[model samples]
Target: MKIGVLMKQVPDTETKIRIKDDASGIVVDGIKWVMNPYDEYAVEEALRIKEKKAGSTVTIISMGPKRSVETIRTGLAMGADSGILIDDPALEGADCYATAKALAKVMEPENFDLILCGKQAIDDDSAQVPQMVAEFLGMPQAMVIDKLVVSDDGKKATCYRRIEGGAKEVLEVDLPAIVAAEKGLNEPRYASLPGIMKAKSKPFKEINLGALGLKAEEVGAKGAKLKVKKYFLPAEKAPGKIIPGEPEDAARALVKMLREEAKVV
Candidate 1:
């Protein structure tokens, strides 16, 4: 079995974000970057699958700027066999569609039996790329899966997914399908010293748009069907009001406020 994991580098969730002066985008100068948290879950699942299947290899695939190589290396340290980084200026501001197209191109030759990725990237939270990649490859896609069991022959997969109203859905999909992993699937492991050292020599390949036979105008900001007109921080929330009075009076006042001022009742 050959499994492909789609990874992404994103700003650390704890980092404070700043908007650019011109309101065009977020300030990246002082931000710390790390693997998208959900992507880590995908990588861990891929490693688990590789362990169960003989003669199996897990490949990490990503598209981002130059620094994305570091993110790929992190996956290598997590036990992925190799890494492929698609770094090019033309993909700077590409939308989900353009990114899926580029990634689909890179994945064509590999012909993986299964592809896994996070449900969404934290930065934009679009939750669209993996499904789009499946569509491009003409394969079935199972989204937001929390549990997965591959057949002994590696020809099919049974997946468990969470749904609305606290229900779960079980699905069976053929091999060579896309699966978007959700949280609670499994806990990710940290890379040890030896794994980190081995990652340095792992098979890592970097490719550009031209190398993938993609045109400059067909990807990145140029090919994006959606564009960000401006980016501004949301307005600060107002402080809570405290009613100072007797308990019974306060309760009456709160109900009055809810019925009148807040109008929530």
Candidate 2:
């Protein structure tokens, strides 16, 4: 089986983000970058499937600035056979739809048997790309998959996913399907020294919008249907107020504060 996993590089959650002066985007300077956390789950699942079904190959794909190569390398180090980096200035500032369109273009010739992606990227949290990619490819798609298993013939797979009211739904899909993996599917493994060394020797294909026969107007901010008008840090949290006394007194004080100050009681 040839499985393709879509990965993304995002600012580390710990990094302090600053909006650009013009409000066009965030200032990414000096911010540490890492693989999207949710994507890690997808990669891990792919690796697990490869392990279970020996002879399977896992390829990672990512689209972003040059720095995103590091994110691809991270996946390679985790045992993905190879990677492709779709780099182009035109791809910058793209929203979910444009990004998905670019990915679909690149994946058209790969003849992949499966496509895996995170349920949502942490940076945008839009949760739109996977479905869009599936739509572009005209493939069946399963979202928020918590568990998965492939049939012995590798032609069909089953998945358990979360639904409304905390229900779990089971789906059976044929090969060449797209699945958006959720957290807790499996624990991801860290890259070892040997894996890292081998990753350096693996193929890393880089393609640009021009190479893909796409125009600048089809990607980036111009193609994005949504726009960010402003960006700013959230307001600082207020200090907590403590009520000290016996349980009865504390409860009374809490009730009084809720009724008078919060007006929620």
Candidate 3:
């Protein structure tokens, strides 16, 4: 089986952020970038399936600037056979649709048995690209997959996913499908020294818009249907007023606040 996993590089969640001067984006000058946490789950799941099936190959695909190679290399160190980097200056500031369109264009010519992605990218949290890719490819898609099982013949796959109100649903789809994995699907593994060394020697193919035959107006900021107007941080949280008293007095104070100030009771 040749499985393709779509990965993303995002600002590390722990990094402090500041709104840019233009209020159009966050300042990333000093921020650390890492693989999207949800994508890690997708990568781990793909690796597990490859191990179980044996002789299968896992390929990691990422679309971003050259810096995104670091994220792809991380996946390679975790057992991916190779990586592809779709880097182009014109691809910067692409919205969900354009990004998905670009990815679909790149993948259509490849011989892949399955495609995997995180439920959403951490930076945008749009949760729309996977469906868009599936639509573009004209393939069946399953989202929020928490469990997966492939048939021995490799013609069909079953997936268990979480739905509204924490309910789970089972879905069976044919081969050449796309799956968006959720958390609890699998635990990611750290890169061993040998794996890292081997990854350094693995193929890392880089392609651009020209190579993919994408028109300049078909991607990036111009192609994006949505625009980021402004960004700002939420107001600081109000500090709670501490009430000093015995249990009865504290209870009375809480009730008074809830009834008067909060107007909840």
Local distance difference test, each candidate:
0.95, 0.92, 0.91
Sort every candidate by lDDT, greatest first.
Answer: 1, 2, 3
Model 1 TM = 0.91
Kindly report which residue stretches of model 1 are placed more than 4 angstroms away from their true locations once superposed. Answer: 239-265
lDDT of 2 at 140: 93
- Residue pairs whose backbone atoms clash in candidate 1: none
Cα lDDT, model 3, residue 88:
96
How many clashes (backbone N, Cα, C below 3 Å) per candidate? 0, 0, 0
Candidate 2: stretches off by over 4 Å: 242-253, 259-263
Deviation of model 3 at 11, angstroms: 0.9
Q: Provide the global lDDT of candidate 2 against the true structure.
A: 0.92
Clashing pairs in 2: none
Ranking by TM-score: 3, 2, 1
Residue lDDT tens for model 2, 20-114? 99877799889999999989999999999999888999999999999999889999999999999999987777889999999998998998899
Instruction: Please say which candidate is ahead in TM-score: 1 or 2.
Output: 2
248: Cα error in model 2, Å:
7.4
- Estimated TM-score for each candidate: 0.91, 0.92, 0.93
**For residues 1-265, what per-residue lDDT tens digits would candidate 3 score against the true structure?**
8899999999998988899999989998988999999999999988988998878999999999999999899999999999999999999889999999999998898877889999999987999999999999999999989898888887888999888898989999998999999999988899788998889799889999999999768988899998888999999899978988998999999999999999999
